[model samples]
Structures are given as C-alpha cells and as structure tokens.
Target: MKKITLLSLLAAFVISCADKSQAPGAAPVPLLPVATVTNENTITDSEYPASIQGKVDVEIRPQVSGNLDRVLVDEGAYVSKGQTLFKINERPFREQLNNALASLHGAEAALINAQLEVDKLTPLVQNKVVSDYQLKLAKSSYRIAASNIEQSKAMVASAKINLGYTNVTAPVSGYIGRLPKKQGSLVSASDMEPLTTLSDVHEVVAYFSLSETDFINFKSHYAGKTIGDKINHLPPVSLILADNNAYPQKGKIDMVDGQFDKTTGAITLRATFPNANGTLRSGNTGKIRLGINHDNAILVPQSATVEMQDKIFVFTLNKENKVSKMPITVIGKSGVNYLISEGVKSGDQIVLSGIDKLQEGQLIQPEKSAPKVAQIINKK
Candidate 1:
C-alpha cells in the first residue's frame, strides 16, 4: 500500500507541473521598435522638373549675298558686342564700290560741264549775245545734272554700306554657337538658314508650364508676397538637372504668363537665375523648388506606414503591448518621412519591425530597439 501511494504522489506532481505550464499567466512582452514624436513646423520645399534657357537667343545670318570666307570665332566661343566674328571675301564688294565711285565721278563731271554752259549762256543772254530760249535750256540741263549727281551719291553710299557687310560682327555680347555655314560655303541674305547662333549666358531664364489647377493654387497661396519676399520671406529654391544632379545656384520667379492656354489648360511661367560662371547653360533641363508652410505635425518613416486600397495605416502598440492597426492621414512627404496631418499623435508607441507576423490584440515578444535615427534624420 505504501509503494502504491508514493507512485500516485509522483504522478500527481508531474500532472500538476504540466497543468501549471499551460495555465493563463503574464508573458514577457517583447520590446518593439519605435520612434519618439518630434514637433516641427517644418517648411517643405516643392520641387518640379524645369528647363534652363537664355534670356535671348539670336540666329546669326549673313546680311548680304556672299561666300563665307572665314569663321573668326570657334564653336562655343564667348563674343562681345561689335566683335568681328566672320570675314567674307571683300574683293567683289570692293569692285562694286569702285564701280559706284566711277559713276559718281562721271556724274560730277557732267554737272560741272552743265554749270559752265549755264554760266556762259547767262552772260550771253544778259548782253543779248544769246537768245532767252537758249539760256533757259542751259539752266534746265544744269538742274538735271545736279539731280543726277545726287542720285549717284546715294548709289555710292549704298554700295559702301553693302561692302561693310563683308566683315560680320556680333550684334550682342554673348556666347557663339557652331558655324552652320562653314568656311568656303555660300550664304545669302534672303535665305532663313542660320550661319551661327549667339546667346547671352551671364544670366539664364527657366521656362515651365503649369496647369490651371496648379496656377490657382500658387496664386491662392502667395497672394501678397513679392518675388523678393518670396525669396527671402519664404524657403529657398533649388534646381535639379536631367542628370539628377542639383544645381548650386538658386533661381527666382521672373514672370507668369498673362493668358492661360485654353487647349492645354496651362499657363507658362519663367524664372531667372544668375549664370556668371556659365555653368547654367541654355537648353539644359532643370528643376525648381518652392517653399510652402504647414503647422505642427507628427512625422513617421514611410516604411513604418503601409497602404492598402488607398488607405494608409500604421501599427501601434496597445497597453497590453499588442500590435494594433491604426489609420493615419499623410499630409506630405518630407524626404523619407511622411508628415502625418491627422490620425497619429504625439507619445504614440509604434511598431517598426516584424509587422508581417503581427495581428490585432495578438500578444508579442516585443524586442525593444532604438528608433531609426538615421532614417528619420535623412528626411531633412
């Protein structure tokens, strides 16, 4: 009987221990990855893809018909106002000028002969040596000769002006482009073919088109601010290129179109930027950034937020340390963090990892880890 009783007690002890292991009790809650709430009235700059252009681009064309003799400037050479850029063969122009001069000299000689005849006839008429009709005829001939001299003088002037066209000079101070009509090629004044191109690059203009909705929004936001106010009073503008590299110099809003494009429902705007170093070139792509204001807000890493069917959600830890789904309103994305316009507030512990295995009210062994500092700071 004693041996049987001892065996029963040992069996009962084992069963009790097994039952105790399966009993409902407190479990260690695994520390979850979380971020602290930061209050920032951050000014987020809006960036858009833009293009850089010159204030004025001029196509260089020959003014008179001739063969191109020499292109004095190389491709991409900076030229100054009145600087000689090309030299055409002046031999033909010189010959034409010589012909005009000869015509002028002949006209002067005829005028002198007519005047001598008029003077002699006037004395003869006064002394009754010549008839009045003869004197009148000499006067008429002198007047006609005088008119001829004036016409010849005009012709000579025009010829000299045309000859001056042989030396092509830059009309403006700018950078010159490649010679479209190379040396030894024939060019004309009537043709539209450009001999070369010149553009002022000390400062550049950026042209961009915005839709009506965007235009209205911009005007509504900045109704009372001047461009200088926008530059100094607001956030600084930044430029980005097609290669995705950010341009160092900042730009300002130069102008906005007066009329909206009806067909496209858009309005064109232009911005000017200093290009003293010629780094901001014409015909290059760029982007602009403008600042907008938002009030106190909560920000969270974009990775911590999940979207489903157009709804954004974030995992939150409850009092029992259980993962719960919470909806959030994303105001804007500042770099890598999403500014929560609503829904999430300060002092909320959020789950940053192991979101895949999480369920609402499900107990978890939350392993406490530091919030992503680098990830948050990178949003700046």
Candidate 2:
C-alpha cells in the first residue's frame, strides 16, 4: 500500500509540471523585418557627362615666298603678339630691293641730263639760235626722264615691303602648335600654307547639345529662366577628359545658341572656363554638368523592395505591428536606389531585410531596426 501511494504521488507531480509548461498565452511572438521611410522631395539633383573646350582658335600661315630658313618658336610654345615665329631666306628679297634702288639712281641721273639739255635748248630758242620744235622736243624728254625716276622709286618701296615679309610674326598672343613645314622647305605667298596653329585657351568654351524636349521642358518649368541666366550663377564648370582624373579649374556658361538646330532637333550650348594654368588643351574631350530644379517624389532602398513576376513589391509594417505586402510603382532608378512614385508614404516603416520567412496575417512580436544612413552625392 505504501509503494502504491509513493508511485501515485510521483506520477501526479510529473503531470502537474507538464500542465504548467503548456499554460495558455505563454509563447513569445517573433519579430518581423523593417526599415524607415524617406521622402524623394529632398533629392532633386542630377549630373551628366560634359566636355571642355576653348573660345578661340587660330591657324598660323606664312605671308612671304621663300625657303623657310629658321623656325623661331618650337611646338607647344606660348607666344605673344608680334612675336617672331619664323625667318624666311631674305637674300632673294634683298637682291630685288637693291636692283630697284640701282634703277632709281640711274633714272635720276638721266633726269638731270635731260633737264640740262632742256635748259640749254630753251635759251637757244629764246635767242633765235634753235627752232621752237627743238625746244619742245627737249622739254618732252625731260618730263619722260622725271616719270621714269618716279616709277623706279615706287618699285623700290614695293621691294622693301616684300623683304619685310621675310620675318613672320605672330598676330595674337597664345600657345602655338607644331610647324607644318620643316625648315629649308620652300613656301609661297599665293598658297598661304599653314605653318602652325595657335589657340587662345585662357578662357575656354565648351560645346555641347541638349535635346529639344528637355530644352522645352526646362523653359516651361522655369519661366523667365533664360538658359544662359540659369547656368550663369550656379558654379564654375568642370571638365573630365578621357584620361584625366579631375578637372583642373572651375568654369561657367558663356553662351547658349540663339537658334535651335533644325536637323538634329537639339540646341547647342557653350560654357567658358579659365585655363590660366595651361592645363586644358583645345580639341580635348570631357564632360560638363548643369543644375536644373528640385521636385517632390518617393525614394526607397533597392533591398527593401522585392521583384516577383516582373512586379515590384515591398513588405511594409502597419500600425498593428502586422507585416503587409504592398505593391509599388517605380518612377526612376539611379545607382542602387529606386525612386518610388506610389504605394508608400514619407512616415511609413518599410522592411529593408529579413523578409524571406514572413507570412501574411501571422501573429508576431515587432523589433525596431536602426535607420540606414545614405551618402548623398550632390549633382550640380
């Protein structure tokens, strides 16, 4: 009887413990995934690839005809106005000038002899020793000699100008390119061959085109906002070359095309940048950026949204702490983010991660996750 009572007491204790373990409403509710909401209105900037260019470029050519005796400046050399760039062989030009001078001297001597003959004949004709026809002939001879002297003087002047042309000088201040014709090569004035190229790069101009649609949209959106004025005060422009890592200087818009292009349906634009350091070269390819306006929209991290069957969706946390799957519309995609246009508000808590095991209407505990900080790259 004692053994049966002990066994019954032990059995009752085990049953009591099992019943306590299965008590009502004691299971812990699991937490669901979550994320904070953000408004797309705050991010209203964009960037594009632009090019660097110069406002002025010129080609240098020789004006005189001769053998290129010497080149005064090397390729890629900075030069000033009236700077001598080349020296043509002046021997031939000097010889022509000397011949003209000799001709003038001979004509002057002839004129002196003819004048003396005319004076002697005039006295003879007045004294009735020579005929009137003889005096007239002497006078005509004197006039012809004088005309010859004048013609020779004019020829000398022409020769001197041609000789001066042998020394070629720069017409403007700028950097020069390589010589097209090497030294000892013959060049002509009629051909006017390009000897080198010079460009004024101190203030460079950038050339680019914009679509007609974008141009019209900008004009309509921003009234009284002239294209030139819109980009004028923003910031100095920058250039990114094909190989260069960064732009060397800041620049600004200098000109916008007065007329739109009819063929391409685009408008041409230009921006000027300071190249005091000579870092920017003409004919270089690079990128340009211009800022427009700000707008209100929706933005969300790519991870928070899941794509199923070509449809985008996000798991959102409701006020009841219940997980709900919401369908969303994406307006634009930039980098690793999506700009949402519908289905989410600024203050809603959306799930960023840990959504693979969640089910609809499942009772659970909610755990708050820390908001993710984003690095904003300003596009101006």
Candidate 3:
C-alpha cells in the first residue's frame, strides 16, 4: 500500500509539470518598433558632373611676331588690367621708325628745291626768257614732293603703332596661366598655342550636361510656360567639389544650350557661382546638386527596408499585428528616408527596426510610439 501511494504521487507531480509547460501563451511575440506611413512635402537632390570655368577666360597671344625679350609675369601670378605681360625685342621696330622719319626729311628737302626752281622758272616764263612749260614742270615736281612727304608721314605713324605692340599688356584683371614661350623664344600672332591664358575668377561658371529625358523631366517640374521663366522661379543650387565637400556659396542657373548634341543627345547648361575669395579656378571639376520638390509623397525609413535580388521590400503590419513583406516603389531618396510612390499608403504601419529578423506572417507586438516622418524628411 505504501509503494502504490508513492508511485501515484510522483506520476501526479510529473503530469502537473507537463501541463504547465504546454499551457497556451507560453512564448511571447517579439516587440518591435513600428511607424505609420505619411504623406509629406520634401525635396531631393540630383547630382550631375560639371566642369568649372572662369567668367572671363581669354587666351593671351602676341599682336606682333618677334623674339620674346622679357616675360613680365610668372606662371599662376595675379595681374591687373593694362599690366605689361611680356616684352618683345624693340630694336627692329625702332629701326623701322627711324627709316620712316629719314624718308620724311628727304621729301621735305626735295620740296624746298622744287619750290625754288618753280619760283625761278615762273619769273623767266613771265619775262618770255624761257617757255611756260618749264614753269609747269617745276610746279608739278613741287606737288609730287609734297605728296611724298604725306606718304612718308603715314609710314611713320604706322611704324609707331607697330612699336607699341612690342609691349604686351593684359586686357583684363585675372590670374595668369602657363608661359609656354620662354625668353628669346620666337612667338607669332598666328601661332597655334597662345602665350598664356588669363582667367577672371571673381565669378565662376559650371558647365554640365543633361540627357534628353532628363531635360524634359526638368522642364515639367517647374511652374512656367518657358524655360527662362522656369529658371527665374527656380531655387538656388549647390556645388559639390571634387573632394566631396559642399561649396560655401550657392549658384544660379543662367544659361541652357539651344540644341542637343546629335551624337550624345545631351544638352549643356551653365550655372554661375560667386567666388569673391578666389577659391575656385578654371579647369576644376565638380558636381551640381539640383533640388526637386515633391508634394504629398509617401516616405519610409531606410532601416525598415531590405534588398533582395535588386528589389527593395518593407515589412508591413496588418490589422491582426501580423507582418507581411511587401515591395515598395522608390522614386527618390531624401536624407535617411525614401520617397515611396507605391506599395504603402497613409495610415499603413511598417516595421521600423529589426526588419532583418522579420519573416512573412510573423506576429509582432508593436510599440505605441512611432518615428516622426516630417522630421526625417526635413533632415535633408
């Protein structure tokens, strides 16, 4: 009787423990943060490769051909307008001027001799001591001498002008480029390469290209009947330097190409930026960031999305608190959030954290608080 009671008690204890272990709700659902999708207005940036150029880029070339006597400015030097940039050998030009002056003197002396002969012949012809033809010939000679003096004077003036060309001066105030021709090197007005280049960097222009489709989309986003009107209403843009840093100043779109390139089908556009500090230079490269605004756009945090086979998906919560993996159509990205066009709507809840561990049809206990979509959109 004692063994039977002990065995029955032990079996009862074992059954009690098994029943407790198999009770319903023994395992708790995972508690994950969830957020409701909302419609918000936001702006996204589009970057395009751009090439920088100064507002005034001019190639400095000689106006006359001669040996370079002196290079007044060094490479990368800043110069002012009317500053002498180079000096050519002036000996040849000086000699030419002297020759012209000597010719003028000779013509004047001839005029004096002709005038004397005409005076003597006119008196003799009046007295009938010689024929009138002698006086006429002497007058003609005097007239020819006077004409020669005028021609010689013109030659002297031209020589003076040519002499002035020997001193090359800057046409504008800017920084100088390379000095390809050294002292004593022969340079000409028709040389294929310029002596140097001057760039006015107080203002800079960035040139970038856009494809045909991009151009059409760009025009449709603005509220204007013409491109010029659209540009007037457009907001200022930013420049990203080669080092991936944003430029301190903002720029405005000022020009657009009239036609697209037939081979590349891309249209070029220009944006001007102020560089009062001389931070930017010609031949520098960067990217132009253009902002586009979207209204009533659906936004989702990137943390809640996952990529699989080149497609993005988010875990959405149903009425029963069950999570379903749904694909979203992402139009663009603003800051840490993506602008969604489809797959989720307002009032829809999505898993905000630990999305990697989530599986389809999984039950989750959503937290009461949600992320601020407006704050995220404005972070851009």
Candidate 4:
C-alpha cells in the first residue's frame, strides 16, 4: 500500500512538472523508437494440402475367372513390364480348350465327309446315276459343314485366349501395392476387390486444390497475360511431407485441371517431383508450398504497426517531428514484416515501440533505431 501511494505521488509530481512546462511552452513529448520504411524484393509463400501419387496408379484385376494358383511377386515388389505376377489355375481352361479342340476336329471330319459326298454326287450327276437335285443337296451339305468348322475354330481361339489369361502379367513397369487376394483364393473377372495395385513412383505427382479467389490472385501475380505464359513462367514448388519434413527434391508445376469442380469450388493443380530414390509413393499425404516474388515491395516491421478495431495503423512522424497514426494496407507478410500495398509509401518514418500508448497527432521524441519485431518483447 505504501509503495502504491509513493508511486502515485511521484506520478503527480511528474504530471505537475509537465503541466508547468506545458503552460510555458507545449506538452511533454513522448520518446519513441522509429524505423524507416524499406523497399526491397520480398517473397510470399502459400501452402496447400496435397495428396501424392505415382505417375501410373493401376488396379491389378484378373481378366479370367480361376483359382489363384501362385503369387509370383510379393507385396511391394518392383516389377518390369510384362513380368508375370500371378498364376491362376489353368486346368479348367485347358479342359475347356480340349473340349473345343475335340469339337473342332469332329466338325473338320464332318466337312471331309461332306466333301467326299459332294465329289461322289458330282460324278453320279454327270453319269446320270443320281439326280442333279441330289448333287445340289450334297453341295449344300458341304457348305454347312464348312460353316460349322469355322464356328468351331472361333470357339477354339477363344478358349486359347482364356487359357493364356491364367498367367497374369504386369501391364506396366512399377511397384506392387497391397495383395488382397492370397494364393488359392478364388478370384474372378467380376470380383469386387482387385488382386493388387501397381504404382510407378519413379516420378511422383502432388495434387493440390486452389480456391477461386486464390487462383485468381495467383494468376494475376505472374508476368504474362495468357494462362500458358503464366504456367510456363511459374516458379518451382516445394513439398512438405506428412511428417513436416521438407522433401529433398524440388518440383515443377506442369499441369492444371481443365475446370473448377462445381461442388468444391476449387481447381486442381499437379506438381511433379523426382523420386529417384523411390521414397515417394501413391496415396501419400503432404503439403505443397508455392512461392511468389515481389519486386520493389515495401515492408514494415509488424512491431511498428498497431491494430485497432480490425484495422492496422502505424505512427508516422511529420517534418515537425509530431507523430500521427496512419492506416496501412497489409497485402501479405514475410517473416516479421508486413508487405504493405498502400497507405504507406517509401521513406516514411514509423514508430516501432510504445504503440499501445500512442495517440493520433501526439508530439513526441523520435529516436531512430533498428528494432526488429521479434526483439521488441525484450526491449527495456
């Protein structure tokens, strides 16, 4: 209690001295640290959540119905194009092929018999031993037998194709994903679940979406008027892995979706990154970082600015050294500074400290100092 009273009396004595001094001249000036507005190139970064995938993501499905006899490739194995991955039971297919071959042989034999009959009737007709009508019947029979043989040949070809399908080969060069079906599992052509998945991860693509407003802003920041020029001139992007570690390799934005999705109101973009070490894979979640550079950008230390009722303000000293709070338009931020678009120009003097106690048009002592925003909390 005594300390509080003593402090209040000291404050009153200081106020009395200030009032007497002001009565003679003006008011007591508040000492403030100031920094000059700087203009330089600044880069702003934006991060969007992204999903990573390989260049080719394919579901391994069976083309023929059969019991899985062998799984040649283990899960997550690297496979070359046309490499055998699975083998289904070929016994059933081979039996069907034998049946088709037998039918085809029977038809061929019938065709031979019909041809003999036609030959016999042809000579008989010439000798007048059989009627010409009988010869015509024999010729028709021969044509029917030929048609039957052709039909049976088609069946044999189809069976052969099915038998070949028993050995499933990798259609592309990639790494195998999860193996859902085990050996001896009855897999069919119409099965709901795929046998496995294959992903070519040599180069991975990170897909991210941009909101319509963000997309427009991004396009406007580039140097070109056309979309192609903007894309071609775009800077490389970086990837943040799921664990928040930065990916070692940088990526380039090469593809954009045709249009915005109606339901999501966002446009998709793809960035390709090299996975030479085969670290990236399909279905990985990450973030994509995009950088935008601004030339001759005006930057203000955040400590020099004050926010009042959601508007940002900074105290500028006029020629008379009187401080006046002025509003500044903050377009973006880089580290500890706000990139002001308007309301503050280059070479303006801004107060860096004691902002909470400042009033508009207050006369004060201006001290030129280079105090960073991060160091303000440690100031005396």
Q: lDDT per residue, candidate 3, 1-380, as tens digits?
A: 99999999999999999999888875679999887778887787789999999999999999889999999999999999999999999999999999999999999999999999998888799999999888899999999999999999999999999899999999999999999999999989999999999999999999999999889988988888999999898899999999999999999999989999999999999999999999999999999999888888888888779999999999999999999999999988876788899899998888888999888999999987666555544563
Q: List candidate 4 stretches off by more than 4 Å.
A: 1-35, 38-42, 123-129, 223-226, 293-295, 301-327, 334-337, 351-380
lDDT of 4 by residue, 206-256 (tens): 999999999998898898877778889998899999898999999999888
Top TM-score model? 3
Please state the error at residue 249 of candidate 1 in Å.
1.3
Q: Would you estimate the TM-scores of all the predictions?
A: 0.78, 0.65, 0.86, 0.77
For model 3, what is the error of residue 187's alpha carbon versus the real structure, in angstroms, after optimal superposition?
1.9
Model 2 C-alpha lDDT per residue in residues 1-380, reported as the tens digit of each score: 99999999999999999999888976566765455675544333233455555556887777778999999898899999899989999999999999999999999999999999998888789999979999898889999999999999999999999998998888878888877888999988666568888887887777877788767754654435566565544545556567746577666766778888899888877777888878887888776755444365567777777888998988777787777888899865554567777888778877666766666754556556455313221121
Worst 10 residues of 2 by lDDT: 371-380
Ranking by TM-score: 3, 1, 4, 2
Better of 2 and 4 by TM-score: 4
TM accuracy, model 4: 0.77
Query: Per-residue alpha-carbon lDDT of model 1 for 117-233, expressed as tens digits?
Result: 988888889999878999899889999999989998998998899899999999888998877788999888887778888999888988878787766666655536654443344
Give candidate 2's TM-score.
Answer: 0.65
> What residue runs in model 3 are displaced by over 4 Å at the alpha carbon?
1-27, 105-150
Q: Indicate the TM-score of model 3.
A: 0.86
Clashing pairs in 3: none
